[model samples]
Target chain A: MGPLIPNEIITGQWDFVIALLIGGAFGFVLEASGFSSSRNIAGVFYGYNFVVLRVFFTGMIVAMVGLLYFSYMGWINIDLVFVLPTYLNSMLLGGFIMGLGFVIGGFCPGTSYTAAAIGKIDGMVFAGSTLIGIFLFAEFFPLFEGFYYANNLGNITIGEMFGLSNEVIAFAFVVIAIVAFYVTWLIEKRVRKNMTEYKFE
Target chain B: MNTNSSAKRKPNYLNPYFGGVLLGLLLLTTFFIAGRGLSASGAVKLSVVTVVNKIAPEHAANNSYYSKFIPEDGGSIMFNWLIFGAIGTFFGGMFSGVVYGRMGKLRIEHSPKISKRTRIIAAAVGGLLFGIGSQFGRGCSSGAALSGTAAFSFGGLLVMALMFGIGYVFAYFFRKLWI
Candidate 1:
């Protein structure tokens, strides 16, 4: 009954507009939460600040739990929602590359755009490099095409794989998030005490 | 001091927990309406497809990866939802910057220890790798890791865990860039 565009509940010219509106909210939240600053985002990896971890995991858990609840209440159809098909080998390899990129670049694609908007030259450079990297990948698509499509698991979910209900997985994430938030708070306090170069500003 | 005066006027960022709750609500809204979570990389891929179609339409049409993006009865790739979303992200970022008074002349942000040149080089390299990686993985952090994993997608969980795990593993080597 939902996913308005796909279901014809909302159609014609409004689809793009709705997408923009949602994206605007997404960007505003990221920037306002200090994601526009590379230092702020990088702080999660360092023990100085755990804001990234808190926001990211909290958002994930909330969305997960919310979906499960919505399905239970018969408000939304879970079957209609899109799930990215599992390509185990490529996902692992790709994630490793992205991890390296995150540490070196100091900005993800979304955050880099926000950082660029706020006049960060590094952010602009990163954005440019992303375009170039995509171009390069396209040029050599033949080389990695096999690996990219390898080990397809047909949009499987963790619940299905692990024999657990979606609710249980969501609950476990909530618990994990709470523990992470608490642990990181302690770590941040300890790390900030020794730091000489960085400040909250 | 002059610095102290400037610092006093600078807007304070939203508290992390508060921001997280708000973001979580936003994510929830997205699922309810769109039946999916948020994504960022798809827009970038759309941009790539559009560019390729323009310069080498034939080649782009032939490539399995690029062709998937171009509609069979093609008109303009710029009309995609993801492209519009990205434009909105730019505006949203600008709006936030305006409210916070963070808008100003462009400059490279880096740790005091690193030179601007070093920071730029690293950023470019990192972005290049991410570009290629996202294609292979079928998504990036926002698309695959966050949204997919939130839906309990196996591939999504794998990417999220591995990406963060690898980030921590390699973070120490890049300590000077940030810490």
Candidate 2:
């Protein structure tokens, strides 16, 4: 009964308006959480801070649980919601490359924009180069087109892949995330004590 | 280090878990209303499509990837909701920055040992790589790694795992840039 837009319960210009509002909230939370700082983001890898991992995992678990609950309560129709399609080889390679970028750049597309908005020159540079990178991909699409389309898994969920219930998978994920949080907290404390150069700004 | 003024002026960030919870709620609300999660890189793809179509109408129409996004009716590709959402992200970030007193003159962020020029180049190159990678991966951090994992998509999980995993794998090599 929910997913008002796809179900036509909400239509036309108002849809885009709501999208803007949602995006606003998304961006606001990101910036307010210190995502506007490149140093904060890079801290996850260095062990001086684990803000990125904590925020990301918490958000994922919370949303996942919220969706399952909403569907169970019949407040929303989960089937109508969009699930990102899978392209295995492309994603694995792409993710690897992006990971390298994250370490070097200290920002992702979304976070970089937020940082740029707050006047971080590095953030602005990263954001600008993204457009160029995208353009390059489009320009050279023919070369890797086959690789991109390889191993099409077609809208599969992890629950289905592992033959687990969504609830079960979600539970497992929550447990893993909590453990990670605790481990990272200890690591961060230790690292910060030894870190003399960078202050958690 | 101007500790007194810095401490007095700089607003403390919201607790990370609280911020994540707020973000999750926002994400959930989006699904409830729009039936989709938040995305950042998808919007950039649209921007790329729009720009290519404008600069070379023929070229955009000719490409396999670009043509997929080009409207049959020849409308603007920029009309997508993701673009609007991204614009909102910029404004929202700005608003938050102002509230937190984080807004300031443009400055390149880097480690003390690194030259500003080196950091800028690294950021640009890193961004370039991420942009291309997102196209291949179908999304970036928010769309693929975060939202996808939430939806329990295997690709999402894989991307999230591989991205962070590989980052750790290679972090030491790039430690100079950060640490």
**TM-scores, all models, native as reference:** 0.96, 0.97
True contacts kept of 2: 0.79
lDDT of 2 by residue, A4-54 (tens): 898999988997898788888888899999898888898998999898988
Off by over 4 Å in 2: B1-11
The weakest ten consecutive residues by lDDT in model 1 chain B span: B1-10
Give one digit per residue, the lDDT tens place, for model 1 in A1-201.
665555678888888888899889988988998888878878888888787898889889878888888888887788888888898888989889988888888788888888898898998888788888888888888887888888889989988989998888899999999999999999998998898667665
Per-residue alpha-carbon lDDT of model 1 for B1-179, expressed as tens digits?
Answer: 25986478445788888888888888777777777778877888888888889999999999987887888886787897788878888778878988988877988888899999999999999889888778777788888888899878989998888778888999999999987
i-RMSD values for every candidate model: 1.4, 1.2
Local lDDT at B28 for model 2:
84
> Which lDDT value does model 2 have at A192?
82
Docking class of 2: medium
Model 2 has a DockQ score of 0.76
**Top candidate, metric lDDT:** 2
* RMSD, candidate 2, Å: 2.0
